[model samples]
Target chain A: DQQVKQNSPSLSVQEGRISILNCDYTNSMFDYFLWYKKYPAEGPTFLISISSIKDKNEDGRFTVFLNKSAKHLSLHIVPSQPGDSAVYFCAASALPNYGQNFVFGPGTRLSVLP
Target chain B: DVKVTQSSRYLVKRTGEKVFLECVQDMDHENMFWYRQDPGLGLRLIYFSYDVKMKEKGDIPEGYSVSREKKERFSLILESASTNQTSMYLCASIPGQGASGANVLTFGAGSRLTVL
Candidate 1:
């Protein structure tokens, strides 16, 4: 069973527009949510994250919102640029973890067109 | 400069052949992980090491084994490769220092393996 899921397989947005990527999880125990972006041949890099205590976290143009009651989280990228186009993965883990509770979604491929 | 490094970028081997994928980290972090990426399945952990000579099995550990004899290296061993085992393998590490960075992974440029 998939503990975390990205319902959208892909998304397309115009440059300078806002891009939103969503994710859901079955495990309510997950307290932390993270977003990672991956390029074609490169490894994934951390983008942003949100703690359950806070409903939202923003880093520059990127913002992550978590709805603990809904067991859902979303990533928002404002003024989506070509550089922001990549496979974005939503990951979660129950804290006090050494790696066991961690789970990642299938990922959403975002394409930004100029 | 890459903090985490996977030795091979691509590899192909016959069925039943022994395969080994190596990972190294220069960050000197205490924890390292091995994960496989498959279409629609996302990243599934195969194994993880917290300290030298100490390892733990993750969600998917079958058909895989690992070695972490030293702090900077972790090796994943496939005793007998199978076609179903073909996928992209990634190595990652966390700071393990505090809650803020513990769950964040710094991954290596993955190794794509094909078993035929």
Candidate 2:
């Protein structure tokens, strides 16, 4: 059973446009959600995160919105750049477990067309 | 910066061969994890360690085992290599207690293994 799911396998967007990526989760215990960006040959790096208490969190060009009632979250990147092309993974964790047992979604490959 | 280093960037082995993937972290983090990433499957946890000589199985620990004899090093072992085990293996580390941001893990580049 996949606790987290990223329905879209891939997405393509033009540069300087807004890109939205969606994710869903089945576990209600998950209170913290995070997004990670991964390049072809590198490890996934932290991008932005949102706590269940808040509906949204923003960092520079990236913004993450959480809808706890719907058990869904979305990541938005404005003015997408060519460098933003990579796989984005959505992960969730609870309080004490934190990063240890994080459940990760399949991932969505984002291609920023230049 | 916290650095997690995987001993090998790539490896190839035949069936039934015993394989070991090593990971070391420079930060004395109490939490260490091993995850495998495959196409269409994302990242799945294999094993994790909280402290020296203490380990816990993750979501997918069927054909794998782990070791953490020291605070800075963790090892993943494949008792018998099989084609199904071929994939990218990643190691990550995080501090035990702190702000929520500390939950962010520092990951190694990854080790791509091919079991034929």
Collision count for each candidate, in order? 0, 0
lDDT of 1 at B114: 97
**What does candidate 2's lDDT look like per residue over B16-82, in tens digits?**
9999999999988888999999988999999999899999889889999999999999999999999
| CA lDDT, every model vs. true structure | 0.91, 0.93
Q: Give stretches of model 2 more than 4 Å off.
A: none
lDDT (tens digit, per residue) of candidate 2 on A1-114 = 889999999999999999999999999999998999999878899898888999999999999999999999999999899999999999999976646768999999999999
Q: What is model 2's interface RMSD?
A: 1.1
Query: What digit string (tens of lDDT, one per residue) describes model 1 on residues B24-61?
Result: 99977889999999888899999999999999999889
Model 1 collision count = 0
> The CA-based lDDT of model 1 is what?
0.91
TM-score leader: 2
Candidate 1 lDDT over A61-113, as tens digits, reads 99999999999999999989999989999999888766556799999999999
